[model samples]
Target: MAISNKVYAMPPVVDANSRLLFLGSMPGTASLAASRYYGHARNHFWPILYRLHGAGVPDASYEDRLRFALAHGCALWDTIASCERKGSLDADIREAVPTDIPGLLRAYPGIEVIVCNGGKSYETLDRHHGMHPEVLRRAVLKVPSSSPIPTRQHKGLEEKAAAWLAALSPFVKPRGDAQGG
Candidate 1:
């Protein structure tokens, strides 16, 4: 049987200095249950971040993870404000209502790049906001999802991490930036 339920996304993890916004499609089952993004222990999202910047992960509390991300000028959010889905799988999503992308960009004026965590997120944003190519052209980037579930589409974790790091590097300030320029 298909489990149908409304899923809500967490508030954007943002700050005045946010320079990059990472958007996922929607919170999965684990994330929704924990009321935290990427709460699943097997998920590579947090680990990837740690690998990129050598920040605390695999041990730090959820709050600390958020602090580290924000301190590095990275913002996290999901594209769909709400959606009906059976499980964590993005394919099961239906009747997706997108978050206010324009409002977010306006509110976080420091955001210079937009990174979609997976194809679902990129597709959702494109479907809803593709009409304005000019806005998207500014930086809407697509990156592999950090979910543990693997697929033929993505090679492997290492490849995915490399792509993510490359895409995010331009927008993410160097680690030394945290020490102040």
Candidate 2:
């Protein structure tokens, strides 16, 4: 038996030390129900994260993953603050309330890059939010959708995705999660 969360996508947690930030559009049906990020069965987020670190995500708790991300100077967040989804399809999002990133960036001055978790998140940021050729100077790499919704490989896109994660790997160190506090 699984519970369901109906409000919105859970915000990715990070501490002051996070150096990289990952942004998705919103929580999918699976994620929302689990009250966790990237809960979809087919979603490759876990695998990709594990691959990046050359190990598993440490534990089942999202907090643990956040700790891993923080230790590696990485942060996780969604592109949309709120949205109405008939189910989990990003294409089904009706009215999206984008998150205010500049504010978060200011609070945590260490973040160097913002990686969009999927193509939808990427398009929303690039198309709707006015992050264009100039805004993309920060390097908004459109990575593969980790969603298990469709397993069809996105061709050479995986290489770019792996590279993006690799760029942040040097910072990951053996550190326990801060959630205990």
Best of the candidates, TM-score = 1
lDDT tens per residue, model 2, 25-128: 88877787888777666667766776665565345776676566666666778878887667778878877877776667667767666778778788777665
TM-score of each: 0.88, 0.74
Tens-place lDDT per residue, model 1, 1-181, is 9555888889989999888888899988989899898898878888787667755344469998888788777889998999888888999999999998888887778888888999999999888875664346458889999888886776667778888888877655556565646
Worst 10 residues of 2 by lDDT: 172-181
Clashing pairs in 1: none
Instruction: Report the C-alpha displacement of residue 95, candidate 2, in angstroms.
Output: 1.1
Off by over 4 Å in 2: 1-7, 56-58, 131-137, 151-181
TM-score of 1: 0.88
